[model samples]
Target: MIVKYTKPGRNLIMVPMLILLTGVSSCASRPPSSVLQPVRLVQNESEKITLLAITNRDRESDGKGFGSRWAAKLTYEKYRFSIPSERKSTAIVYPSKNPDPRRQFVVTARKQLLDSELIDDATSAANFDGTVAVFVHGYNYSYQEALFRTAQMAADASTLSPPILFSWPSAASVTGYVTDRDAALYSRGELERLLGALAKDSRVKRIVLFGHSMGGFLSMEAAAQLKLQGRRDVMAKLQIVLAAPDIDVDVFRSQLRDLGHMQTPITLLVSKTDRALTISSVIGGERPRIGRLDIDDPMIR
Candidate 1:
């Protein structure tokens, strides 16, 4: 009886309902999922092979160029038993190339990658001293930033000697965090290679490696690789210093364990005020490692 009373409007309602049903059915009949999209894996190979020649205008301004030459000459004269006048004469002939201001000190540090001589020179210096300090930079740092940081650290720490900078191409863009991380990882193998080469020189006293932010992870990875190679003696020469490392504390600890009783002392410089590392911790979905412990924390101690 109700159906008989139903008007044309009621029939029209069914038309709209049918249309909706058809639409839904069409949508449902389509592929259940989007086609798997291929993701491009960015390789940090570009940064790995890079070598940057460091030159600074400020070195001249600060008289570091003159001082370095003087130091070199003085050492050559006193230690090598050569005449100071002869060494000074040679230094004058070389004059350290006026400390090339255009030469990149930090950003595109890979320029030296092609130069075996430069790498050899660095390695030679490290081996000669029996100790070397390698500095790695964090995210968003330019070549200048690396150079300035290295210089500052070298100047500040009297015991921190023979500063060598392993500059990775950071892109130095805040938005390029992923790229920067990839680059840091990419260059890790190179760092390992460098350390391995240095280790061959028994003359090397110790290797003090300093890394800030992502550099910390790279340093850890490099050290771990060195340890795994049965070169614990080389690892013994490694003193790893991490400053506001952008790494999961757990992961970092695991890396340390992998290093397995390195004679090299590990030190971390963490400050709760480190804003960059704090953001990294949040993105990584973990507690801020820097805030979780101080230098004297039992976990670290």
Candidate 2:
């Protein structure tokens, strides 16, 4: 979502920023560790979900956790969440203090995962299916929010294997659209490295790469990088799913041209009613965004 300021209509650029400003005003982000502080109590009615998170963000100065800054090195951390029994579908509630596990999500456990422990734990979680789901979140996300959101999606899907989250450094601010865009592009190679790591393990037979919003753009970039590099061995085990991706139409066509010869077909989850993408299109001088693609258009068909 690199919003280049153009002269066509200065009015057009303000539209998205206005929306972003209004959006952030209504929903302010909680304190850094507000929802992330570990809750030792495990509720009987709540379901416990564990996941693997891989990130390129800088760790805290004290090395206790991660921050919003970008980093060159990759990190692996394991997390467990307690999903509230009373939680509504598609609703996520972050606690400000004294979380109620039966009514709100809670972080039960978290720790760094060593290289040797990653495979053993990943294999055990995959169980008989040998499938691993990796999620890449879009722009305007903090590391904690990404972790919680990934766990929620995994819980909703009832996935069989452990979910791995690829968290890139995002400014996590409404005004940081360009910063997030650069960070997303910067993390594509790291995403490829994550794939390479999982592909080497014999137990991981299937890898699903799910990216939402701008993260979908990163996913495609990494996929194209692998394709051009002749990484067929890793590509064979990969299945890509892009949900409401904020990718440009012409750029997507170019990427598809490069990826057309691959053995597996890509799954695109598009919607004409995605307002975020509608604004994104307007910001890009009214250029078409793939997420807002009209399937019935004659030229598109």
Candidate 3:
């Protein structure tokens, strides 16, 4: 796919909010997203979408949900979510303390898997063309949110590749812009290791990396890091997709310069009228973010 760059208009500052404030619900009001919500295991097997999760977030001591704290080591696991069969044209339904398997998305199972074991599953579960999709979530996302989101996308998409998620330690709050940014940066080495491991897998032939929002920034940083280390093998098998990336335009340009020529062209999805980006722009010293793109700009050309 083609990577298109766009410039933001001068009116982005009018929205007048911060990229850090989102909803009315506090962290307390929200149900535990990572706790394994009950589901009829045998009967709901058909509705299950399992994810290969690689995270650097510290696991909560209760073993229910993954907290936002960063960890010194990365962990690999597989989580299975049962998609609600009774939903209409709605988004993912997060399971609460008491959830209906037929109406809300529920966490059916969780398993801690070895890194090599995950690679084996990923290699064996590739798409027809040997493509493995890795999803890197954006800012203010908890582990369960990222996990279920990947499952939702997998269930909606046409591809048969098994879903994989690269979850960094996001503070999981609307006010976590700076916190999430630092956490994403700290997890770059972990992401590099995940990509490198997939590249080294003999059975895996192609990899499609998907990043949204701030995760896109982390993705670019890891790619640059890999290039500096001269990991041509990993770069050869990788294809990048950045959707609504929350990256600074100048930073992205510099990252591009560092990456040089890629084996495959990067695909970027951008919008000119994203109000959320306007808030982010104002916060970033009124500098436009990449997501607020205007492709007609001469510099983009």
Task: Enumerate residue pairs that collide in model 2.
Answer: none
Q: What TM-score should be assigned to candidate 3?
A: 0.86
What does the lDDT read for residue 56 in candidate 3?
92
* Candidate 1 residue-wise lDDT, 230-266, digit = tens: 7766776777766556777678668867876655356
Off by over 4 Å in 2: 1-26, 62-64
Task: State the lDDT of candidate 3 residue by residue for 1-301, as single tens digits.
Answer: 2364422222121111112122111355455654554454444544766678989988799876678998888788877777778855425567656677777777777788998889877766534456788888888788877777677767656456567899999998877778988998999999999999889887778788887778889999999999889999999988887766788989988889888888778876666555545656777898878766666667765
Query: Which scores higher on TM-score, 2 or 3?
Result: 2
Q: Can you write out model 2's per-residue Cα lDDT over 1-301, one digit (the tens) per residue?
A: 2111121112320111111111121136554654665767734636888888889999887665677788978888887888888877646677546778777778878888885576566778634487877888877778877887777776766767668899998777766767888999889989998888888888888788877778889999998898889888788888887766789989997888777665546666666666657666776799988766665667654
The TM-score obtained by model 2 is 0.86
Give all TM-scores, in the order shown: 0.57, 0.86, 0.86
Residue 203 CA displacement from its true place in model 3, Å: 1.2
Clashes (backbone N, CA, C under 3 Å), per candidate, total: 12, 0, 3
lDDT (CA) per prediction:
0.47, 0.73, 0.73
